[model samples]
Target: MAKDMLNAVKDRLWQWLSSDPGFILNHCERILFMNEYREIERQSSALEKMQLLLKIIIEKGDDSCQSFVDILRIHQAHYWQLQQFFKPNTQGSSSPTVVADGGSVVTAREMENIRAKSINMKIETVSGAGGSQCGNSTGQNPQADYIATGGSVICADKICNTSTDGDFNLSVTVKASTQVCPGLVDETLPSSQEPAVKMIRQHKEKLVDCLRSDCSFILQRAQVKELVTDRQYQNLKDISQSEQTVIDLIDRLMSNGQKSCTLFIEVLKEPEVLRTYPQLKDISWC
Candidate 1:
């Protein structure tokens, strides 16, 4: 039963982590805080604790959990070495430490630092080599080198061999292909909106007024009811029941043959309505 409960909790935690990648950091922080404060009891089994610690380390994707990882590695290796024919060194030294196999004596912290330094050295070496190669390649392309030095490449280029500085003279000419007339461009521009958008934009004010009036009427009626004693309060049910009335008001206000139903639906989906009605927060417009 205990193992089943642990598995269930682990499954739920994994599901939450998979749903939101950003939640892992918060989850790890919460777990660490709980462990520190003893808000939750620790696992009895070392293997269970190690499993949880490994999961947290994988989620963290950083060196913050290196100590715990090192501890687990040391325990696993020592366990295996004890069963082998050639056992590892377990003799205590005068300096209060014992050397493991291969005659190396280093603490987990020192090993971690050494690994970090080696990684940094490798990265720096690769970056320096790449930079030198890029520099040489760019130097071979005169046009690219000129652009890299803040010179713009435009239009036609004529290369002239000169005897002075052993450098070729590059002549570039830039010219506009056509003049732009504002009036002609404006007349030629295609309209982005369809006929429905144009109709909505033209009659937006009338639609807004109609909606406001319908809401006021619904509020007045709702206020008159004995159950609704508060005149200022309105709930989601009130708005839902009066939806048809608001739609009818919009239809009456809008011009005929303008696909006004879609326009009204769009108006209802506006940000202003959502802000005004907090109860409609969960409504899916799509």
Candidate 2:
């Protein structure tokens, strides 16, 4: 029964992570830009929830789930650092403000604060799992070792003895950052004025071909094949959609009378777009 409960929690977390397109896009943008502390905090909260679920799974889940837990651990480590980056610098100031360190500029006390907050928080567990639904154990914090050494906290044996009944609610509640459209140039450049048109044209075709190849490869995968039998049709549709998105972005940049190939490459590398079609990473736009 415990094993089944853990599996259900794992499945729900996986579904939440995979099904939210906007969340994934936002997450990618946060990782790429490293700005927006609010978004980082939102993501950090979600990661904390997942970390709790993972701990539960490790304690009672099947051996197969171990590999998935290991992968999640890597993500947890990454977000841990990000959480520290965005952690409020309240040690010296009366007003709470996020620490926007562009580089490695954190103090030792700040690091300790991050570690404490991560380990000391209480994560509400999935209810009706036939066990205690809180994370506190023996009225003693189970995070002393982790806090001292700055190591990963072990939550397997720490079970909270409280009762709460509800579905596992891990949704992040934060307003998304405002979206700004790229400025379009009023005057169009003549063919003679654009020196890299030929190069761009060739690069565009190469990108489209790569997108089609990636679509084909995705359709051929065993997991995808089981869900969709019309592989050829799906592959074509995916390829067309990816190609159009890339072409549209490039066209917008070029229409702005932008001459720099490097700028065009950077726009294409935006996290929102790149998260959807990672195959473009292989292209040498320069």
lDDT of 1 by residue, 54-168 (tens): 4554455445454433332343322232122123343442222222211111222111212111121111111112121232221122211112111112222222331333332
| Best-performing candidate as measured by lDDT | 2
Off by over 4 Å in 2: 1-5, 11-61, 79-264, 267-286
lDDT of 2 by residue, 39-58 (tens): 23233234443444444335
Q: Rate the local accuracy (lDDT) of all candidates.
A: 0.33, 0.36
Deviation (Å) of 87 in candidate 2: 19
